[model samples]
Target: MDNDCMNNIEDRKIIYQLINFAIKHKKIMQNYLDETGVYQAQHRLLMEIFHNQNASQNHIVKSMDVSAATIAVSLKKLEKGGYIKKEMDEVDNRLNKITITEKGKKVVEQSKQIFDSVDGRVFEGFTEEEKLTLFLLLQKLNDNLNSMEDELKSKKERK
Candidate 1:
């Protein structure tokens, strides 16, 4: 096979590995999230809010990469459970800003501990340099995906 074809085959294998890794990671995290009385999506959303207090619903929807409907459902559940509060944006009554409550902060702390432990488990044998390289490569891949999304959106707008 030509070198280019060989590289293509190797890249496909890498893609497959990445897909499998994501599936397994989700499954593992689900158990942890469940124990904390939140779904994986909710946990992620909570963490996002924890990082960005008083963020608008629209911002959360974009940052979480979840549908608006999904965000609504998750926010409702979180709010009902007293984990978060949704206050109307002072400048924009139409927009609701999400703020984590004291209860929600506790959850975030717990989740952070779980995540830190999980991270250790995932990278137990990896050296510091290997971990850094992996982080950089994943970031590059994420950037490429974002660019592809932007291009697709531009094309759609042009059409």
Candidate 2:
């Protein structure tokens, strides 16, 4: 059966396959994190700040699709690590902006290379077109998953 068709299957055998992929990939990423001396969420925040020094806490909260408290914890951890700094926005006392320090920028640069290598290794043997196809497919899968979240919430309300 085709891959997408399998996703519509009974007993969710396809869901189990997706879980295996997630588990295996999480293990791979955990290995990378262990070698890198920090967690993935911290790494992501640094990367985001590297690209946008003016990033706001609310922006990170929304982008990460996580709680503001969770982002605050990560932000505080990064701040304590000297990887980033938070400055209050001049226009709004309620809004704070994040910026990556020079050290943080260096770490981000190094992590980018590491992640690139990881991706290359993960997709090794796949042709460039195949890689693009996989990328598009995953993008669609992610969109579908996100769309289901609201449906799941509504079902829980009914329950």
Candidate 3:
């Protein structure tokens, strides 16, 4: 096989591995979330509110880059579960200010422990140097993907 063809095949194999890794990681996370009774979407929304206390739904939609309807649904579920409380904005009565409840704070702390445990297990056999090297490589890959996205946006804007 030619050099270019060989390179393309190697690239494909790397991408396939990356995709599989993401899927498996997501599955494991979902399973953990299920056992904790914290759906992924609700967990994310709860955490956002927990950190940003009194955040508006619109602000969360923008920060998360998700549709308002999607955020609304998740917020509703979170509120119903007593994980969050929504009050009308004092100045802007049309908007609801979201705040994480005490229960939500506990959940956030629990989630952190769960994530740390998962990371420990995932990197159990790796040495410190190996872990650092893997982190650096993953960061480089993330930066490349961000650059490509920016380039695509620039091209589209130019058109």
Candidate 4:
């Protein structure tokens, strides 16, 4: 059987392959996180704040696709580690704006290098066209999943 044809299998083998790849990818990502002295969610949280210092907890919750409680816990941990600081919004006392500390900036730099190396290694042999095609396919996969999730949520809310 042609390797390309294997992707067309309709017996759910593709799902299994995707699941296996996710597991392996998580392991590799964990190794990168191990060097950063931050947990997976914490690293993401830091990067989000680094990119958008004006981000509020609500914004983080939506952007990270994580529960509000998860963001709170991660924020608390990051604050304790001196990697981030949350200050009351000047315009709105009820909301807090997140900011990355100088220490967090250093962590971001190190984590960037590590992740860049990981990406380089992962796509070592791929040409530029292959990379674009892979990204496009992945985006389509994500769109399909998101649509399914929205449908499920709507159905659940109706019951």
Give the alpha carbon lDDT tens digit for every residue of 21-83 in model 3: 989999998888776577998888777888898999999999988999999989888889898
| TM-score rank order | 3, 4, 1, 2
| Cα lDDT tens digits for candidate 4, 1-159 | 898787677747767877998898889988877888999889988999999887999998998899999899999999999999899999999999999999999999998998888889889999999999989988998899999999999999999
Range of the 10 consecutive residues with the lowest summed lDDT in candidate 1 = 5-14
Model 4 TM-score relative to the real fold: 0.83
- Highest-TM-score candidate: 3
Candidate 1 segments whose C-alpha is farther than 4 A from its true place: 1-9, 89-92, 139-159
For model 1, residues 87-151, the per-residue Cα lDDT tens digits are 99889899998999999999889888888989899999999999999999999999999999999
Provide backbone clash counts, one per model: 0, 0, 0, 0
C-alpha lDDT score of every prediction, in listed order: 0.91, 0.83, 0.89, 0.91
Q: List per-candidate RMSD values in Å.
A: 4.1, 4.3, 3.7, 2.6
Cα lDDT, model 4, residue 78: 98
Question: In candidate 2, what are the lDDT values of residues 1-159, reduced to their tens digit?
Answer: 899876778746766887998899878876776665557888887777788778999998887788989889999998998888899999999999898888787788778787788778888899989988989987998899898998999999999
Stronger candidate by TM-score (1 vs 3) = 3
Q: In model 2, which residue pairs have backbone atoms overlapping below 3 Å?
A: none
Checking candidate 1 for backbone clashes, the offending pairs are none
> lDDT: which is higher, 3 or 4?
4
